[model samples]
Target: MTRPSPAPLRVLDLTDDLGAHAARLFVGTGADVVRLERAGTGAARSRAEELHWHAGKRVQRIADEAVLDARIAELAAGADVVLESGPTSRLRTPALREADPSVWADVVHVLVTPFGRTGPRRDWLADDVVLSAAGGMAWLGGDPGAAPEPPPRQQAEQLAGAHAAIGAWLALLARDRTGSGQLVEVSAQEAVAATLETGAIAWIHGRSVPGRTSGIYGHVAHRVFPAADGHVAGGYSGSPRMWDDLLAWMVETGEAEDLAEPQWQDGEHRWSGRPHVDEVVARFAARRSVAEIAEQGRTRALPWAEVAPPSRLVENPQLAHRDFMVEIDAPEGRLHDVGLPFESPALPRPVRLAAPADLPAGAGWAQGRAPVTTRVPRPGTPRHGGALEGVRVLDLTWVLAGPYVTKTFADHGAEIVKVESSQRKDPTRFAPGMRLRPGASYDDSGYFLNFNRGKRSLALNLRTSRGQELLRALVPHVDVVVENFSPGVLARWDLAYDQLRDLNPEVVLVSMAGVGQDGPWRSAVTFADTLAAMSGLTYETGSATRPPQGLTFGLGDMVAANAAVAAALERLHRGEGGHVDLSQLEAMAAALGPAALEAELGQTVRPRSTVMRCAGEDRWLAVGACPADELDAAVRALGAGSLADLAAASDADELAGRLQALGVPAYAVRDGHDLVEVDPQLAARGFYTPLDHPIAGPVLHEGLVEHLEATPGALRTPAPLLGQHTEELLTELLGLDPAELNTLHEEGVLQ
Candidate 1:
């Protein structure tokens, strides 16, 4: 049977890396993309190189204002989806939606920027540094006295790009059922902040800033050590078993007599004496090549890998076998880049497009596109059937990573008590896009709403004696307490895990820090999401032609949050109570995954540009998605016609319908419409609800998490107004009488 036609995606391709990457991903996923470019920064070579990002897109250059305005209006009316970077300001989306609400409502508009669309810093100039610094990334990087380093590359921007892509996909999925679309605001700052790993978690628990350190590699027994050949690689000898295996391997190979004590033969014994073990391992490694050591280590199942450079990575065997790199033909030449890592058993390969070579000079580009055709619902509250149901989490996290992990648990089914100090609310409360009026409270921020949903908030002054008493009173009710603070912070607060364990031994505690609890640099440095950039993740991205750019958003923080969630799940599964030290840098380092393995083998890889040109226009094609033997046959699949013509058999709606008929996944890209208009996945999952807000009228909101055949969790009410539940909670949880509550309120203990 013939495959179904592709979907229609409309993108306002601002001349930025984030927007470019978003457009590129959309096209790769079988959407017919239309891109809008302007005159400024229109360098011929730069424009030519855009082909690497615009391969599957049709481009148009905006010239005169009159023509541009008319074309934009026409395009917005016709487009199914809309994506923009710098152009998305408070002024743009609302005005356009008002002009033709029906047409605009059918479009999923994604605004990508350094800050969100409505924050105090929304109008400020931003790239990586500004975003990262404002997002509190710089606060945790390098040494406290040293100049703050931005991510080594353009991280904030790349995170923005990734989120832009994800937000668009999610919006489109939402639109599939509700027959409308909504504006998706993405902030590079918030994205970066979101990836602070456990730093924020510790802030919630310990009220301290997580510090940074040099190349300690985080958690477990990991670090980058010099090999015999003057190359560096990561090695994990922290585990008792791994340490024992390494010693045994050395002894078995007849290389064990370098003056190390015999107690090193046992894993537990060695872990306690890391310094001695390090000295012996360093000496032994001085006589072996990285590859030889790595091979031998792998043979013995010891975690070790050489540090690899970008240029050499293009030919890395494991990555090649996994098809992690793709080559797209562009005007400049073929460009190589990292491809999507997530894969499904059914869909093995995604079609890659090369950017086009040229566009009509001064042609009005923002014209001719179809609108969103589906109306999927928003995702809702957690279901009772989740594995975490009945679990109680004492969420002491602020900012990003810690909050994010706890939020995931809340999304699933855990009851979360998000404890914060009024003196230091989560930065996001004041960071951006808070729909605050002249005298609104902290709850007005969209950032707070987005991450803290379905969680209870408790404002406590942890620095006060009374606050300490309150926490001690509350300890017995919680199953877990998670924090991300600098070393010694919780201990300083007299709330260390040991102290807490004395009160409730069954309670699990997870500590997230920039570095682990033990390391030479543990107290000397700080780190943030940008830690990924410094640890060679960014260096592995972008083209060799330019310095590696940071991912457009705070990916390191996000990845770390996922790791934290996974770790939490693991701990819960074991049903063992202990402290879990999650190092932010270690989590970010782990995202490097196989790359770490290759690095340990003493290989280096290069970061080649993915921007290129195609089809007499500027576009980017996947560098080598078409197999060597199937290139000619695949090219023939384009069917010798304009992309629009190839899609002529049906509009986006009919195409999706046909694809669904064939049991394949497909949907149209859409513009600013409603919360629900084009999300097929949401429809399939039943994840949206129309809720009436006091000010926003009846609007679509995210629905429930997970589907259960039996019992399920439910949200009886939306997040309560600030202080709305104060009385009930105080009366019930604290067993306070009305008169006592009034006295406490008068004493400023409760808001």
Candidate 2:
């Protein structure tokens, strides 16, 4: 029997550059998105920009203001969702619902702006660069002595779009349960602020602020090493095995000099003696090609990656093997762009529809009066429980991406069983110098603590048959299973989606791999830095004159985590579970849609410029496109006759405050330390919550990114110790007897 097609969501997209990616996400997810533009409007700066954002959407131009309002009211009267991205004055949520009460009763309205709808800075004029500076990201890039660099492309705008997508999905889920729609408000500044990695948390709890580095943070050996052909991002930190492997590789190449001494054997000692280790590694790398290092290092589990550019990514072997890039025919020619971040059996493969043909010169306005008839069924109340309250997740993920996804679920009241093994612990647990205090154990690393919060630890060695049985036993009680191992690792242990389905028919399996499950490079190992390089982010992150640099740590991991949450929530709303194959490379690429579109269209992708500078050491600003008068006022407020004079001032924050008070789009560049104690806005909004840890005392945790008034999420517990709840979880969920557990422990199957 032929199955009926899935119902398409009706989405009305009224957004500019700020919300283009959000609308693109809707289109990718099979939404019937209709774009509403002004008649004769030419807002797109270039043809490439126009095609990059507007292609694959049905467009309708409205000439009269009253007619536009009526058209929106008519569309909203039947649409499932309405997305707006301009200022609040242009598209207010209250005004949209008021336009036609009955028709808009159940339509989700999403608002994306620089700030929020109600705030002191709500009406302030800003752009992507300005928002990045305000969010403290700008302050964390570039060299410590140089001006902080803003990430290339519109990252703040793209991040806001990502958050908006998550918010939209959350609202849709809520609507499905209560038969009511809501306003999913997103702030560009706040969205970027939340993804600042460990900087903000460090400042609030550890009283330490992170600064700009040449490459990865924390480790002295983690930096870009110049190779014969290009550069490779070296990530030899966290584990003694990695450090030893790097030294061995160098020794094999005859580059290890005095550094091969027994004194440098310890990972901690090697870090302290990094000058000698770096000298040897750099010499060895300079003699070899990036390909050689990447290929050889991966075989030995060394986290080394070739720094790649967007153009290079176009021909990446791993990405090509996964068919990560989709070829589309455009006016110019055939172009390639990234596809959806994940592939799920329950969701159809996303197809980019061809751009609409040009409208006739005299397109009549009367065509806008068409009646709306489509109506989505009000889904039954969610049986999965209260906003994820009773959901149970089996978290077999480690490090950043997978743990981040489970952390979100845990925050919203999901029970998360974080499975690990003492034999091969999470690298983050042993990350050097990230401990809360000196002489702290593996579980005391701040990096591990931050990501593993609200999870119960269940240490079971998956290598053992009994351990595999124990995991299979618990699968029936879990609503979801998430992991981020290299593609084939889980399947090797018979824990693949196909295997789990026999135990729990409704279980959702989310696998976050660097490439994907069925790709040629599925077995390629990856870290956050390598994923960035492969995804074309590291290529476009730095200044045009300099070699490409990476963004704040684990950018790809964070983006994939957000996408994972949306995917899980979406499946839960549908009341059906299936495999979700999420690629970290694709997730980060999705956030760079604008750049991908431009590159595919053969446009000259220019590097972002550093605009504003402030007085003080390493203080810079990213004041996008401020009005001429406001710029002038800002210069005058600094009491400087010239830019040089402004740069010589003693305090940039004080000057920024004065300019901000004068209604100028300006902000002082802030490092993690600066934001912890100084960001009044984040404090006012309660973006930090204190959680009591048994050993660390009261530690502050980051707050939720999205706000759902009816069911806001919370951080309920601290991070668990290694195997802290193994006995409890085994007894309660798997009904394992004490004798069996003791036997398992004696057999080394359970830690």
Candidate 3:
């Protein structure tokens, strides 16, 4: 028997590699993706690299004024949204807007650019490396002494596209309410800037520019210790209790005697002499295998795991049990990769993305292709609203994904009472410099300061019944709770989603577990934003076939955060706010939505060839993946006779146009110098927010995703200080009497 058609989503997929990826995500989400191919030769068709991103999209070719106008009319009349990565200047072109006058006010239009539509360089050309440099991500990677190395691959562009997808949904909601759509403009540079960890704050407040530190560990006390089997990135320092547990393990393992030495006796001394300290730890770890160290760490309740690559990650037990990784037979063969970024336990077919692909038209042509299965929403009452507003959320989310989602609610005016267990504190609180002292107020890790902005903080001990009781009492008064805990921790405290939902039926719980909460691989797996590398994303990145490299920023986590925001928005629309089983793994998978369809079809979407350097005079004029035949012609058209000759000509738009007119596919490479020099479109869009922090002065915040006609979300206040609004919230929202509030403070329940 034949199944019914899948549900529809409005997507305007523009030309380019990044746009292809973004469009694919919506396709996976069961959207009707319409890829707008160029009018003539359709260079995108020749770029096999784009096939992975275009799996579920329906190809529609349109060029020039007349044809585009008809196409735009048809699309705007039917589509729910439009996704574009071209210049806003292009959008403003009469011919372009004439085709879809309804697009701006009737449907969500997501515009993606290297620099936002309004920045000075909006018209400038950019490749992944150039945009990464402009966004400041390059400053924090690579060897300290060498030039700031570019990020691994297409991260800047890909991330902006993901954010653009979320932004589209937000605009769509507003359209659903107000009957008017707005422009959602995204800048690869700006999106990437948000993911630079604490580097921006360090330069702004600390007056220190964070230089590159390749192979150096992040601020968290994680390290890759030696084992008989392989290296493990362990020594998680989530809390003091965790540290104490680790110490106890060392003692039990007969390594405590080393701590008695003057060099290791004091925490400060040991930290100061990290070289020697690491040597000691390394020596001890060498005697054991990764399994032994991990097993001991797990049993002792210390967060520990070995650093694993993609090949190993697919087989991890924690991920397997949780169904974090799913296998769908492609047209060619069965392949394993990460599943959804979030799981709706309520959904009937949770693990399946779509049906598998049929046999290829030709042998090598279908070597790596798969059939996809699409989801059709069970006919039911559709829901809508501030699914999370009025719901008190105690955001324990830190870093990118968690905080960004909570921030979305905060933008919607949610009361987020954040809890910062002082024992280990948020790492961003001590970034740039791992400086933490008992009474230091300057301890603001730009990471913690910026992300925690607009939230109240309460110091508590979940291990203590008093703390747990306070949380329990607060839960009844709250509507939703969010956390990014490792697997199994919440269940141990009897405070998992089920327990919370049981106490409050309307409460919505979101867990940003690194892997997820279920599956054979659930507890056995541990990961961060780097999951992109393991999920076949990185496998198809770069110009070469070397082991896939990890992205420089936390794209995986941030994208997941956006997904949670979308889910919350969807829930709110349904008027039924309940439990949400969110997983970072799932979020990442959702962004790879199109790929899942392709994977199910058994197709292998190989990574594109990275353009390391161009055949030109200026080393900066890099052209990656330029078609073979067009290389020489492209060089001549740009007036660059050779690699050295390429330096003289700066503008690639003309060259791009010429190539397009001739039916050759090509895009100009960009970097820091180029970003600063050209691009006038971004300034017109007004995408940057200037901030003046009391400590970190002259900070620039990115503009909101879209400019709403009414009640647009804006940055009302900077990030808050610890308990800065405790008294205000107590008296204003809860109506607590001053005398009673004083009592609570004295009782150690209030900060």
Candidate 4:
């Protein structure tokens, strides 16, 4: 079999840490990435950071401003994309845009900033913590009574980078058709805010604001429990089968108490009885080692994971088996860091490319080719006529990560066939505290309704041979197959990538397992929190005085979902089809790339900043360094003599607004309520769309994160009910007779 050619594109990276991940992603997809640095700039803050973000990219140093401007214009004329963070002083110049209109028009200029370029907070200076607080993410973690804490490391910056990467890819697809590249603006605050799961939607629809608590919200038994040897994170299921399995395991160890009662059979009752359940589980866990719990959990198919620090992550068996860690030899020394977020046979391997010996002067403008001719499809056509139109996706993913990946495709006009089974439905369908309507059924879950919009459902029980046969028949028709089941589940059902490839020669399969497919710990069960704990994110989050805690939301799931989308799109762009093994743990670790670099270089990773509280319950501010002029202006705006006086103020939003107007970055810690009610920027951008569902009526759902001008994505349909389109799909796609479908339904093979 012949492999598809790599994407032949040139990217100019003129960014600090903010947009590094975007350029890094382009490099991973086999683009020729060139890094431009100032002449007086020192080496990367650490050698490990440089190797992780810039290993395969060429670099050039330019000194004189005039020379730099001319070089940038020349490069812009030849480059396919230019990634820059902070102010766009160089890009907005007439000299660059006018040097070659055709060339400039074809080059995608991605501007990544703390806030979007046209927003009021655009010029405000912000670090990771400030951006997180401004985005309402900080309000989701830490104790309820104490000030909210931002996740450790630069998650806001990385999330922005991920969105920027997605935007760039979408633009490239558009350029492939339209021959015109547009600006892809990414705001760290907006990107992080979108990852708050259902918090924003809950406030918009339910008029209730959720605050940070001891454990993940809505999950009482899902927390890191102390084990004999070390800590282990575990989550109990609300499903009766899993709950019974857990109880049986406890009974085996003589740890079952009140949980053995008949009243505890109901999942809701078990949740309400969390106090008793936690005591019983803790007693059982304290006497058992982490290894023992891990084994038992795997045997019972329970969600359990051992809490791993950075050192353990370095030696993790699952990561090692999947080859998720790559070793690089930089000028400083040898270092090991997280590798590609996902692995694909068609994707290019990482290569070491040295920087250019001499900078190119302004001489290549006349030799550049005219922009490629392409056309964008019109909206409201079949498949919404968006970028990925005509592509067919078979979505077998449940919960956040897998559904989120397919949601991107569905939003971008791909025809998605979501194959769920009534036997093992998506947990989001039963997510606690989220109901579409009073007395709604299982399919009317608010979480499900939000995450699974714009897809057709084919609920089939894969355990049945006939149902598996039907799925096998559908595999040949789909362009891509996505699943997030544990490693061996599909293989057990004879529906793994190897089997699907035999049916469809060019089928692209994306398997997003928690630990990947072939690792030793691949069989270990995991949840969003467990993945965070095992990836060292939970260990690094929280203050120095507090024990390590996981993010209140599924941070790892969002990161992995974005990566999965990028992988699928890259394959489609290259006209290649192959299996993509995506490890959620690796995805989370890649987001913490800089921190890993620091640890690899024997440097202390910075701790979370202290929160500065003000008026309103849980209202606080995250302050970072600011320019002297901005600082002085902020003091004047707040009517204070010094920074200390402003910090002591009772009203945080007032001070934040005054400082923001003065071009200083300070934001009041916003909860879900603030985002829904007061976030004018999000409202102006139409980030939240009020989509009407049959069950949920009108609920506000998050809009597209990537803004494509020519072929913008949109929500076209509400989530499907269980087996809602069974008859339609069978008749239209499978050519199945009505009587045959009725027989299958009667046999309990189809729901």
Where does candidate 1 stray beyond 4 Å? 1-12, 42-52, 87-94, 139-145, 237-239, 253-276, 343-352, 357-751
> Worst ten-residue run, lDDT, model 4?
348-357
lDDT of each: 0.50, 0.71, 0.54, 0.74
What are the per-residue Cα lDDT tens digits for candidate 4 across 395-472? 999888999999888888788899988788566775546553345567777678778899999989887899988988
Query: Can you give the lDDT of residue 195 in candidate 1?
Result: 52
- 164-183: candidate 3 lDDT, tens digit per residue: 76667666555545556566
User: Which of the two, 1 or 2, has more lDDT?
Assistant: 2
Deviation in Å, model 2, residue 573 alpha carbon? 3.2
| Sort by lDDT, top down from the best | 4, 2, 3, 1
Candidate 2 deviant stretches above 4 angstroms: 1-5, 39-42, 98-101, 298-301, 344-352, 356-386, 439-444, 606-611, 627-654, 657-663, 737-748
Model 3 TM-score, 2 decimals: 0.76
Q: Count the backbone clashes (under 3 Å) in each candidate.
A: 146, 0, 73, 3
For candidate 1, the per-residue lDDT at 275 reads: 69
Better of 1 and 4 by TM-score: 4
Can you write out model 1's per-residue Cα lDDT over 1-751, one digit (the tens) per residue? 1112223345554436545555655554445566665555445333323434555566776667556556566666666667767623423445666777776766777667644555333454444444554444544443233333344434555555655665554444345434556666666554554454333423322233344433333223454455776343434433356556676777876776752466655555655776666666677787888677656654665655544454454564534543444455655456554443232122234334565545454443344544334321112223354435556788788766787777766755677777776665455564322322233346644335445666777766676666666666666667688887777877877788888888777677877775456644344233342344334565554334433333323456665565555445434433445567666655554334234333333334323211112232111111211123443333245342332333343454344334333322222321112113433333333334444434333433344322221223343333434444556655656676999877766766664
